[model samples]
Target: MIGRRILLAAGVLFGAAAFAQAQIDNGLPGPQPLDAGSMILNRTLFEGIMDRNSKVRSASAKPMPAGGYLSYRASSKVRQKVTREYLARAEKAYGKPIAEGLRKTLGAIDFVATWRRLATRDGLRTGDLGDSVTAYWAVNWLVANGKENSAPGQMQALRRQLGPLMASNPGVRRMSEAARQEVAESLMLDTVVLAIGADTAVQKNDPAVLAKLRTTTNDRFKQAFGIDLTTVTLTNRGLAKR
Candidate 1:
């Protein structure tokens, strides 16, 4: 009985020592690294860091799909190449030191749509460029032959792009009227080109989509610029609207 009692005592001591050693070796840290700043900083810095990180992620993220095209990301190099091309073409087209609002308008073409078009039809290799110029050259084209209310979506898309400058833009709220009008005027040139330049072989290949694209652009142009494109006559001993 004494021997058994001694064995029990020894076992208890052994377990107690083992547990103590484990407690020393396997103890969790009471204060984590992030916890050091969490008290006074309250994580806002961390949250902002996360938010900024997300933007970095998003700049190259796979974009949403549009039309019948597969979506892809044009690499930084390709985007930079296109930007250089755009700047060069734009400089040739509209002289040096491009106006801020006009540059903004041109640069805001749907990247997702642009990338998709490049990938699908333009033969853009992975992370390489197709015709980057065409991406922003005209995002959604408007058929000149269509009715006034025909191309609502195209106009809407243009209007949406135009909005940032229109009162910062019109959809958001009213801001500087003069500045807004100035920006709108700058955007109008693109509108005019689209009105005259929308007929394409690809567009004709898909007639139904082309039709919707037509109607959508018509109403949207009117809605966007308050200018009925169908009625623009280029007056002054002017050209006739054929």
Candidate 2:
């Protein structure tokens, strides 16, 4: 179930592939917040301490162990580098910040740390840095290709289209409210990204380009999680303005 959620979360942002051919793997590696010593302790517990200590609201909180603190700092530096590298690559590929809004959104999210905490709490592995990077690039792709302008409308159209799919899937309906919401949002985001890519292809009258974009998007999602969006029933026409 958690696996499904992760895949859905990832798939939601898959349409960011409309940018140039650069891959997310070209970005820096995922953060390694746990050193050899810290690995001996429960990751959740250690993550809790790190989270509490790192926050401004928790200024009065006790500090993490020296090793944990050092690991956090190291991981943070690497994460920032990954973001910088991704943006630089996008800038070079496109003449400007494509998807500037999306890039800003991604920058605002400390996804590495957030995913680390979430995965640790859920007993999942935490090393899929490429997934997060792909998501960023996907958005960057959208921004670069001018798809960001239509993203909100596309997102809403997708939600309306997905309503029936969500209702029909008992497994989705059975999820906890928070999990369900997350899945819904992720799915919508993925749909929006795909719609933008498809729209770009249509505008350019390039079916081959569309095929490549779809292939790349699916490949990235598959790399992160085994799910493939091509098989999903959601349609690009769903993104059309009503």
> Could you say which candidate leads in lDDT?
2
Query: Model 1: how far is 87 from its true place, Å?
Result: 2.3
The Cα error of candidate 1 at residue 96, in Å, is 2.3
Compose the digit string of candidate 1's lDDT tens values, residues 149-227: 2221222222222222221212314323332222222222223223222333122366654455455554553443333
Error of 2 at 42 (Å): 34
Question: After superposing candidate 2, which stretches have Cα over 4 Å from the reference?
Answer: 2-74, 113-122, 127-213, 218-242
lDDT of each: 0.29, 0.34
lDDT of 2: 0.34
Instruction: List the lowest-lDDT window of 10 residues for candidate 1.
Output: 1-10
Q: Which candidate has the top score in TM-score? A: 2
Task: Assess the local accuracy of residue 110 in candidate 2 as a C-alpha lDDT between 0 and 100.
Answer: 48
Q: Tell me each candidate's TM-score.
A: 0.23, 0.29
Candidate 2 lDDT over 119-164, as tens digits, reads 2332222332222222332332343233323222222223233233
Each prediction's Cα RMSD?
30.9, 17.6
